[model samples]
Target: MATTSGGDLSHFAISSVYGELLSEMSILTAVETGLLEFVCCLADGLAPQAKGHFFGSRNLGASGDTMRATIVLVDDISRQLGVGFSWKNENFAFLEKVAAW
Candidate 1:
């Protein structure tokens, strides 16, 4: 995985967006927000980051419903984008159980 300093523009941009979304929107909890970010990372083909956020969400207490929704949304987005990747490994067993398909 690539590393970036706190001052990096991309890091700043992501932090800014999440800050605003979390503070202003005030709808999703931290775990849900992390899952949403995981989806974005997956969409961008950043598998390491996606994995980090997915597990981070779980660590932060993501519920089964939220995990299922995340899996379904990821499947929908991946299909729509013609993107292919595997999340069926042991590390993702928890997610695989709740996958919509």
Candidate 2:
């Protein structure tokens, strides 16, 4: 018999949820939602989860321009909310490459 690891189980769960959501929306909308979730996680200081969503968004075919726009929107929203949220972090260093590709 085989067993599922914790990471595997979590990945399954995430996939199921996103799959359902993606089924109802356009791919672009779904990707934008993923990016929004990533920013929300960042706002709450959840870097690990944020990183996951960032890659997920990219995997869903979000364009480099879309990702860049999301970054700028998040930054502006953070400023408007008077919160000191920083999107620049070591964990997100791959974003530029992801965006480029």
> Model 1 residue 6 lDDT?
46
10 residues in a row with least lDDT, candidate 1: 92-101
Q: Scored by Cα lDDT, where does model 2 land?
A: 0.72
The lDDT of each candidate is: 0.67, 0.72
Q: 15 in model 2: Cα distance from truth in Å?
A: 8.5
Each prediction's RMSD over C-alphas, in Å, is 5.1, 4.4
Per-residue lDDT of candidate 1, residues 2-49 (tens digit):
255546766655677655655453687676678778778766666677
The true-versus-predicted C-alpha distance at residue 79 of model 1, in Å, is 1.2
Candidate that scores best on TM-score:
2
Candidate 1 ranges with C-alpha deviation above 4 Å: 1-27, 83-101
